[model samples]
Every structure is written in structure tokens, then in C-alpha cells.
Target: MFFQAGASMVENQNADAILLAGTDLGLAFDGHDPGYRVIDALALHVAALTDLATSGRG
Candidate 1:
């Protein structure tokens, strides 16, 4: 997963944008996964990149 994330980040020209995937488990399961947090962080990075691009900073 980390490798994939790195690849994606590299492909984006090392931009600060990221993508995340979220899932919901059954009632018997209720916990957060580290992967999810990683994804969230990536997403934030991506968003910042987008903002920069739109602002002509990229």
C-alpha cells in the first residue's frame, strides 16, 4: 500500500494531493485502520496540490 501511494504521489509530479478510500464494516466491527489514516493524509496532500494548481502555483 505504501508503495502504491508513493507511486501515485510521484505520478502527480510530487504534488501535494492524495486520494483515500473508506469502508464500513458490519455492526460487529468498529475500528479504524492505519491504512485509512494514510489515505486521508494523501487526500489532504492532493487537495493542497489542487488548490495550488488552481491558484497558478503549480
Candidate 2:
């Protein structure tokens, strides 16, 4: 409920996107929506790392 309420509050304030910066926040938002754009930092980090690994640019 804490995460949901915070996200809703941010959305109410007209935020373009709510960032979930904590890695453990997935527990609160994995399959949930707070009626706004939510960017999960951990997910993005993982995606970037995966892309870099596959890009072979080392």
C-alpha cells in the first residue's frame, strides 16, 4: 500500500513518470499499475547490461 499510495501521489502531482529506484520494489509493482508511467530502475539496469553483453563491444 505504501508504494501504491506514493505512486498515486506522484501521479496526482502530474509526474511524467514514477521511478522505482529500489531493487526490491519489484515486489510491490511487478504486475501492478499505479495508473501512470513507472520506470523500474533495476529492470532498466538489467536490460542495459544484457544489451551490452550481447553487443560485443568490449
Candidate 3:
């Protein structure tokens, strides 16, 4: 329901993407396209942490 409404707003407002910051959002958005770009904050955070952990470790 929210994704559908959000997608509509995205199209109407010409927005570029949606950011999924809720933990349970995965249940709704995983493997779902939602007709727009979806940014998973947890994935980005994990990736950044991985990079930081490996950066200065030789």
C-alpha cells in the first residue's frame, strides 16, 4: 500500500528514488522493483563498514 502510494508520488513529483530505512521494509521491497530506484540504507552501511574495515589493513 505504502509502496504503491510512494511510487505514485515519485512519478507525480518526478523524484529520482526512494530510500528504505526501515528494518521491515525488506519484507516489502526485497526482490521488488516498485517502479523506481530503491536505496537500501542497511546495505550501504554494511558496504561502507566493510570498506572501512579493509582500507588500512594492508
Give one digit per residue, the lDDT tens place, for model 1 in 1-58.
5446545665666645433443321111234332222345444567899999899868
Provide the lowest-lDDT 10-residue window in model 1. Answer: 21-30
What C-alpha lDDT, on a 0 to 100 scale, does residue 40 get in candidate 1? Answer: 53
RMSD in order of candidates: 11.1, 1.9, 2.2
User: What is the alpha-carbon lDDT for the whole of candidate 2?
Assistant: 0.79
Against the true structure, what is each candidate's TM-score? 0.32, 0.76, 0.77
Error of 3 at 53 (Å): 1.0
Clashing pairs in 2: none
lDDT of 2 by residue, 1-58 (tens): 7566667777678667778799887668888766777889999999999999999974
Q: Mind sharing the TM-score for model 3?
A: 0.77
Superposed Cα deviation of residue 14, candidate 1 (Å)? 33
**Top model number, TM-score:** 3
TM-score, prediction 2 = 0.76
How many backbone overlaps does candidate 2 show? Answer: 0
Question: Residue 36 lDDT in model 1?
Answer: 26
The whole-model C-alpha lDDT of candidate 1 against the native structure comes to 0.48
Index of the highest-lDDT prediction: 3
